[model samples]
Target: MRSLMCLLFLVIFCSVQMTSSANLAIEVANSNCCGVFSNKKIPVNKVVSYYKTSSICARRAIVFKTIAGREFCINPETSWVRSHVDIVDKRTATPP
Candidate 1:
């Protein structure tokens, strides 16, 4: 009976370790990708900054951060997205 108890404990420990490792791997993988894109347009004035998604991401996208500290993932090819990128670029280029 003692041996059986030890075996069961080992199995549970191994399973818990495996589950934690899997969750960590998934988090690492998702950190580089934006899972969804926002279709709504955010006014340029509301944008605080922008950045491009990682090259490894399947979807080409730009992430815009708003003054209110919210992030919006947008398709990079969209006309308005391009315009926003240009405006943000110019804003960052000049001296304050």
Candidate 2:
């Protein structure tokens, strides 16, 4: 009985430690995951509809959305996308 209890306790303790460690890694990764998909992949044999000819962002999102559904490409690369909004300012582009 004592051995069983000890085993259970150890398992619970290890699980807790693993979860906390995993959560920390998730937080760190998320902080840096935004806007990481800018590098384009050649999307041939796929039909992507563009929202507008003028806006590149809309077009890129359409391409992703068409393939993966509405929310697949949340933050895309701005430079690869043609933006009508002056979307990327020089200030934001330049490092402080």
Number of backbone collisions per candidate, in order? 0, 1
Query: TM-score, each model?
Result: 0.65, 0.33
User: Which regions in candidate 2 have their CA more than 4 angstroms from the true location?
Assistant: 33-96
> Which number leads on TM-score?
1
Tens-place lDDT per residue, model 1, 1-96, is: 999999999999999999999987786687656889899899999998998887657787899999999999998888899889889999889786
Least accurate 10 contiguous residues by lDDT in model 1: 24-33
Among all candidates shown, the one with the greatest lDDT? 1
Residues 9-81 of candidate 2 have per-residue lDDT tens digits of 9999999999989977776554423233434432422323323222312243422323444323323344434
lDDT for 88 (candidate 1): 90
lDDT of 1 at 19: 100
Computed on alpha carbons, the lDDT of every model, listed in order, comes to: 0.89, 0.44
